[model samples]
Structures are given as structure tokens and as C-alpha cells.
Target: MRLFSLLLCGALLTGCASPPPDDPGGTWINQAAIDAARESGRLREALLAYGPNLEWQIHPERQQASYSNGFELVEGRLQAVGAGQWQVTFYGDYEEQLRLQGDQLTQVASGYWPEQRFARAPTRGDEQAPLGSSFEQALYRDYLGGDWLIEEGQGQGGLVRFIDNGQVQGLPGAERFALCLAGDCAAMSGEHDSLWLQAGDQGSPWLFVHEGNRLRIFEAHNRAQFDEMPEYQPGPQRWLLKRR
Candidate 1:
């Protein structure tokens, strides 16, 4: 009787240890997998969705959407709710549903209409293209996204903004400034000659360094060479910019 009881207890424990059944709608996809697919050029279709203080990049190629603020979609399902309309349900920390029609996608919870639009997936070459030097490009990718205010210096020391359209603006009184990345230079007016006129294919005159939430800007003939100079110190060149 004692041996039989022990065997029964063992069987109960084994059942308890088993994982729950997978969701029938879809399988869980992680960020690493999504990034891998994007890097390898396997992403066939993409969607960009915006909400209040949130953004989501959806890849239909993998049936996954990367959400902002760590609100990710582990698994998702698309069901036809009506003609020319489909309901997209994403399973994550909590379940979220969005309405989709053609290229437009809307979030049901927020009632944010026309929240999503189709976009092309960025290729590996697009990701690797240098905005400045390798270091500046790394910093730019990680920290340069929104508006920034230059705290100190002359002329250009006020509002320096970085836009998603690959443009930089708010330089003192100048409202618009184009960004020259690597070998590519977007057309700029002759008015910009007062500032650095000749931008090299390798780097920019305005060098950016990030420390915590603040970004520092420095002016140098060659930012890459300035970085290697023994006298170069981030503290002295005070054009500190704070994100707005």
C-alpha cells in the first residue's frame, strides 16, 4: 500500500511539472528571431503603427510586431472579422487587438484611427551605413531620435533637432539643415556656408557624444582625429544638449 501511494504521488508530480499546451492561434516569436529575420533580408512586408507615447513595427513576413516600452507580441493571430477588415490579436504580457484594412491598421483599445501604415523593412546595408564615423553612427543610432537643446556656446548653441527623415534642424536661426552620412550628401543651400561648408565623406564637423540622458556636441575639423587627440576632453567642449 505504501509503495502504491508513493507511485501515485510521483505520477501527480510529473503531471504538475508538464508545461501548458501551446496556443493554437500562433507560436511565440522573440525579438532576437525578428531581428535575425530583418538582418537576413527575409522580411517581406512591414507595418508602422503609432499610438499615444507608443510605436509598433509589425513584420507580416514573420507575423510579429515589435512594440515600444517593452510591450512585445509573443504570438499573434489575424482573423477576418468583416469584409475588407481583419482583427489582429497579439498575445504578450496582456492581449491586445487591432483592426486592419488594406494598409491602415487601428488599435481597438485606444480608438486611434489610422494608426498603422505599411513601410519597407530596413536592409542590413541600411543598418550599417555610417551617419558619421563608426563611433558617431553607433551613438546616433542609440541616442539621437528626438529634439535636443544645445545649452552652451555661440551661434549654433540653442535648439538642435534630429528628425526621423534624416534631417537636422534648429541650428540657432536656421530652420532646416540636411545630414550628410558617409559618402551621401543631401542637397543643402549656400546659406549653410557660414557653418561648416565642406563636409567630408567620412565624418561631420559636429561630433556627438552621449552620457546618460544628455548628449554633448563638439566642433572639429576632423571629429575622428579629434577623438584621438590627447587634449580632447568631453567636459571642456560644452555644447551639452538635453532631449526634449
Candidate 2:
């Protein structure tokens, strides 16, 4: 009788033993998109390629996941393969590996691009804050160092090669590219992501809006003139470019 009781107790204990639950599962956003440290390195290249508008939702049940940024959005079914190792399978048989550590989550996009980092939101509200100027500067350093296309230049799409950090770009007359303020070219881009970049001959700086995969460079004569504008939309002539 005692042996039977011991065996029953052991069986019950074994049945109750289960793996730990998903601790990082919940709404998460880009860390750099928040009030991050004044460090350009924090705005990771992989994350930037994902786009500034990033939103992720990991279900508490640990079985479903969803990712959305400015460029793409998809939902997937997730399964834990090992400790701190999980895989998400999207529609059409696409799969992505994921690694979760505490409040930070790293996702490998489509098993191609480098893994991008994300942080759990402090609250369920999921508030979004404007990005800083440094984030824009960081883009050229790593994200935009490769070749890009001038969406519509000289009546057709032209090639624009960013040799390194937009400084030595191969853009016809605008040989030297730099983002600065219109009033004072050397002034800091305070509390804003869109800064003025010179397109050379305009005798003025162009308003450069940093959008992942695409860029909108609007001609702004001066700070006072651009400030009066209410919205930012499509620009005319040699103002748009897309990643190639």
C-alpha cells in the first residue's frame, strides 16, 4: 500500500513539472524610438532597417507573435525549441528565429537580416515618442552605406552610391552631403529627426526626412520658410530615393 502511494505521488509531481512561461511576451517597441541614451550606437542598423515605426506583440500564451514596422507586418505561430530559443512561422511557410532575454527580445527577420533588438513597453499604453536627430545621423553610418536609387532624378531612376556615411555620396552636383539646421548649418537638430541636408546648388538646405527603405528630401530655403509648412508629403524633383 505504501509503495502504491509513493508511486502515485511521484506521478503527480512529474505531471505538474512544466517549463517556465514566456516572460518577455507582450507589447514591445523599438528601444531607440524611446528616450534612449544619447548614444547613436543604440539605434542599431538592423533595427533601423526594420523601420522607425516598429511594433511587436508576443502573446502571453507563447504560441502567437506579430511584428510590424514601417515596411512590413506579419503574424506567426511560435514554438519554443529550447531555453531562450524560439521559432516563429509565418504564412507561406516563412520562419524566423527569436531569442528572448528578460525584457529584451531579439528577432531574426526572415532568417536573412541581422537580428534586431526590441524592449518590452513599460505599460500597456505603448506610447510612441519622436526620434532624435542622432538617430538620423546613425542611419548613414551603417544602414545607408550601400547603394540606393534616386527615385526620380533626371527624368528617370538614377544611381546614388553612399560610399560611407552619406559624406562621400555620388550625387551629381551635391557631392558633399550633410544634415544640419537651415538657420545655422552647424547647429544641433534639437528634438527632431528631420534635419536639413544640403543639395548643393539650391543656395539653401533641403529638409531630409529619414524613412527606412525610402527617404524624402524636401527643398527648404530657410528655417523660417520651412517652419511655416504644415505637413510633409511627396516632394518634387530629385527629392526622393529608395533602397536598392
**Model 2 alpha-carbon drift over 4 Å, by segment:** 1-22, 33-53, 126-244
Give the local distance difference test score of model 1: 0.35
Error of 2 at 156 (Å): 39
Q: Which residue pairs collide, candidate 1?
A: none
TM-score of each: 0.29, 0.40
Per-residue lDDT of model 2, residues 1-244, tens digit only: 0000111334355533322445546566665543332233233333344433365676647599777653355788988887887888889998888888766778766545555777655433221322222233333445446667777654247777653234445565565565431223323222333333345555334455556667666654333345563333324445577778
- Model 1 CA deviation exceeding 4 Å by range: 1-142, 155-157, 173-204, 221-238
TM-score of 1: 0.29
All models, RMSD in angstroms: 20.2, 19.0
- Give every collision pair in model 2: none
Model 2 scores what on Cα lDDT?
Answer: 0.51
